[model samples]
Target chain A: MFGEELKQFQRLGFRHVLLQVLNFASVIASGLMIWKGLGLITNSESPIVVVLSGSMEPAFYRGDLLFLTNPASEKYKTGDITVYKIPGADIPIVHRVLETHDVVKKKSKRSKTALTGTGEQLLLTKGDNNEVDDIELYQGLDWLERKHIVGKVRGFLPYVGYVTIAMNDFPQLKYALLGGLGLLALVQRE
Target chain B: MHNIFSRVNNVSALFSSCMMGLLVAIALSTLLFTADPKGNLNIASVKVFPMKNRRVSARKQDLAFVNFNITADLRPLFNWNTKQLFLYLEAEYANGQGAKNEVVIWDRIVRRKEDAVINVIGKNKYMFRELSSTFKNVPPAHYALKYNVMPHVGALTYGEAGRTLEAVPFPESRERVS
Candidate 1:
């Protein structure tokens, strides 16, 4: 197998190998561009996420794919599932909004806005399977602010995201996959 | 080009594209099911009681207890694409400090269509409290039954099933429940 592939590689010439590398790099770049473009359109840092835990079991399972959107004008309401990231926490949590308090901001001297209007929203979330609200998960904060939230979950696809979890669990598998893909791309003709 | 590797690659590529198209079509089909079910939600009573704070044992917080009745025919919301229904009862009110609040006092999950015909007389499962630690000067709250229809492989949809005709005022704080 090695001898045949080596012979074919030499036949393709150095220019063809360079061209293949360029093609692979462009494919990777376009994937990144699409992801960032989706993030910009949805107003979310990560437009898509994979559920790593079973906190939202029965509704969202581990390995499920979630699509998120954070519209600036919309106010999050109770019963809406939101994906929020607490400061100091490494992983973002997906949960339902248990409560929302839209506090009014004090009027400023320079600004002409009224004082009675809604300001930043304070949220409290809870898992569907949990017995109590997620006060302890706040990581010392009293309530979850709009800035802490990544986005509200808009769409879901079951089990499509398990590949990432599997790769994470087994690092060797990830390296093998990347190496195999790279090797295939480099040796393939036309 | 006529090797086994190319044949496998072509077949898999075609299979994945077909799968993508099917998933997209299924996601789009969820938009066509516009089922708005109506129901009745009545707040039987609301009482506030002073209780010891769980996090801060040194201080006491006023906890509001609400008893409500719900009768809603939510079967229409369960379509072929719907996996589960997340039903919740939320209290919408404004505090004396001009803060708008929406709190979910109780919730249930319906996984089957038969269980969607809801009829229940229940009390608040989660603690309902004001940020100020008291319900003092808080205005009357309007209770509503809202639901989220989670699809098996599509967009999540939400709607209100029922709402109280009038806002229910919070009763005076009692030292203890009778």
Candidate 2:
């Protein structure tokens, strides 16, 4: 099995392998560029997110793909679905905004620039499937501030992100996929 | 150049591109159906009562109870791409300290088009509490019925269906409910 592949590898000069490697690197670079570009346009750290849990059932299911946008000038409303990450929690949660409190900050010398603008917004979120609000999930905090939120869901696609979830569930699948892709890139002629 | 692997790759590439095109078409079709439906939201009564804070028994808070009637024919929002409709009743008010608040008191999920016509006279399902733990000195609140239309494969849309013509003032907190 190795003899034919080895012979073919020898037949292809070292320059061809270098070219393939460069091609692979450029493909990965373009992917990263697109991701970063989207983040910049949306003003969000993650412009695209996958629903990891079924907390918002009937509207969004597990493995559904969600597009996010975090406009700096806009304030979140009560009905908007938001994807937020608490300080200590590793996984981000997707929930609906149940309440919003725009607290007025006292005018001080340090905060003079923000005096004309709207005050800080404190939000309370709840899952659609849950019976109660998310105050218990705040991790000792009374309310969720704007900083804890990643972005608001704008667009949705169904079940397109299941591949990532499957790969996460089984580590061997990830390795196998990576290895297979790399092998194909190295061995393919065109 | 035309090996089995290359043929399979070409077929899959073509298949995936066609699938992507179809999905894009479906996503774009959501924009064509633009319907704005109006409804009536009537606030029958509003009452505030002092209650013990569930999280901290040592602290006391004021909870507002709202009774309202909603009549809306949301069937126009249920297009082919519409997956579900999330209807919420929110109370918008401002405090003396210039803090603005919007709290959702009741909500319902409409999954089928037949269920989109909503007519209900109900009370608040979720707790409605102020940030300062009391509703004293807070201005009258304006209640509105809003909805979010979730699509199966496209952008989500939101619209307001109804609103209280005049702000409804919260009654003084009574010591007990008879």
Q: Which CAPRI level is candidate 2?
A: high
Question: How high is the lDDT of residue A109 in model 1?
Answer: 91
DockQ values of all predictions: 0.81, 0.85
B68-169: candidate 1 lDDT, tens digit per residue = 999999999988899999999999999997688999999999999999999999999988989888898899999999999999998899999999999999
For each candidate in turn, the TM-score is 0.96, 0.97
Model 2, B1-178: lDDT tens per residue? 7789789999999999999899999999999998999999999999899999667346778889999999999999998899999999999998888778999999999999999999999999988988888889888999999999999898999999999999999888877757
What C-alpha lDDT does candidate 2 achieve relative to the native structure? 0.92
Tell me the deviation in Å of residue A4 in model 1: 3.1
- TM-score of chain A, model number 2: 0.97
lDDT of 1 at B74: 95
Chain A TM per prediction: 0.95, 0.97
Best by TM-score: 2
